[model samples]
Target: MTTMQLEIQAIAAVVAAACALPGVFLVLRRTAMLSDAISHTVLLGIVLAYFWVQDLASPALILGAAATGLLTVWLVELLVGTRLVKEDAAIGLVFPVLFSVAVILISRYARGVHLDVDAVLLGELAFAPFERLTLLGLDLPTALWVMGGILLLNLVVIGLFFKELKLATFDAGLAAALGFAPALVHYGLMALVSVTAVGAFDAVGSILVVALMITPAATAYLLTDDLRAMLGWSVGIGVASAISGYWLARALDGNIAGAMASMTGIFFVVGLLFAPERGLVAVAQRRMRQRWEFAQTLLAVHLLQHEGLPENRVESRVDHLVEHIRWQPVYAEQVIRYAERKGVVRRREGRLYLTDDGRRLAEQMVARA
Candidate 1:
């Protein structure tokens, strides 16, 4: 891979892992949208960090940004729990105001600042590699180490506290009664979310980072009930989508961030349309096929039982043929036609006989089902 592709993939990997960690719990907690709020409001921390330390690489900036992320969570909680504001409403009222202030600060005070609002909102994955920031002479974007450390730390912490998080998320009252510090866990979660958002910002920008954090986990949730499987599958899908989307963007000469988000969406779309039980097309086709096969099975059973039934009698008398199965004649005929195409049944010499492949397939289906 080119350095640019490697850098983008590395950055995406970090962001994907970090997002997947809290995302599993976030979805379970019904706080999936909170990540969206944190992504937008981190600008306040970023702008303040820039102003206070005047150095982008300062630890103070990262801490400041994380602090602001936590503050945003606290503010939302205060609005929702204390003042009865719906969370979506509170989020709508809060982050935009904070973001507007950050924009104003950058525009007025840090006039000639390279911190563009466009980058703050949309982000630039393309330029993330050229920054070439490193620690101890290892050539890599600083974003990688920052997000990687956060990902590793969160993975360990969450793994240690996995049962606690499940209890706290599913039944906070029970968790509290069991001596789990639900409050402390909640606070820790929001803090980690803040840190994650801030760290991923430089590489993925804000929205794409948010997209990476939520979409894959959410998609996995639709396909799996186990938390561990969900997290693993989510990370797998995310990494695949990241790599695929990077190449797609390179192919089309398109925006990398947009391409990545599009790729994530594509995965979700595939999950929704092709998944075994829940996918739309899969469900429809399954029903269609089940009805078709049931009709074929019943027809075979009836013909086998009534070996002397004429083909004309069988074909023209689909209604009688399907009455036991209650199949619509049109549907029955169509299914029969489909079966015929499969070489399962032949209508010749005014009689029907099952082909060898058809009988074997039918026997296998009956045995399997």
Candidate 2:
């Protein structure tokens, strides 16, 4: 691979890892939509800051964007807390309006400027590697330094307050009762998300930020129950998506960030179908096994019930299984075969009878009931 390709992948990996870290907590807290809100509304902050400072390179832009992100969160929370609007409704009301204003302002006033909606929304990762930053005596891609710093910030925040974040995410009420200040932890997490989004969006775009922030974490959530494992899984998934996505984009001659975002969806679909305990296929298998076990138990109980009664003796016969137990013929045959395999039933003279172990189980079932 060329040096440029490696640089692009490195930047994508850093951006994905940074976004995915806070994303774990966001997914756990069921606040994933907040990333989308912050990503869009932060544009208005940037535009307003640009107008104030009249300089695109000033740090004020990031500060303004971060403030706008926090404002979006505060507004949604305020509206939700008042019980006047639901959380989703509050998000729906806030982000679109802010984003539209930012778009209109850009169109009306900054038409000749470097800022464009495409860069803000979709990004141009292909060009990111060309923007070099000179640190001391070494030259590095600007995205590397920017995304790397944000990645470090996110790591430090998570490392320092892992316990508090965990408690606040899983059980806010319990955390509050225990003097953890869930509200503070929540805002702190939002702040980290805001900062990460701003730093990464310039390279990967806001859409990619939202996708990376939520998708990998959500996929990981499906795969693990332990919080630390979930976080580790999410980071791994994010890095894989970034590297794979770069290759996908190269193969298709398409957008790198979009390719990586697509990979996140692919990974999530795999998890949805194949995760050990929580996946759709696994859950279906468990339920089917449970149904079969219950059917076998009922079959054993019915055979034991008719064992010595003359009038009900025919009920223990294979031919009477369907009519006596109100089972379909095919179902009755299946249960009989299964029971025989389990050594729970024996067939002789075309009649079925429970074995010694089966009789004991039937007795125990009756006793328990």
lDDT of 1 by residue, 59-134 (tens): 8877988888888888888898876778899988888888889888888988776788777677777777766666
In angstroms, the error of model 1 at 174 is 2.2
Query: What's the CA error at residue 340 for candidate 2, in Å?
Result: 2.6
Off by over 4 Å in 1: 133-137, 285-369
Candidate 2: stretches off by over 4 Å:
136-138, 308-313
Candidate 1 lDDT: 0.79
Scored by lDDT, the top model is 2
Against the unseen true structure, what C-alpha lDDT does each candidate score?
Answer: 0.79, 0.90
Worst 10 residues of 1 by lDDT: 309-318
Model 2 agreement with the true structure over 7-34: per-residue lDDT tens digits: 9999999999999999999998989999
Model 1 vs. true fold: TM:
0.78
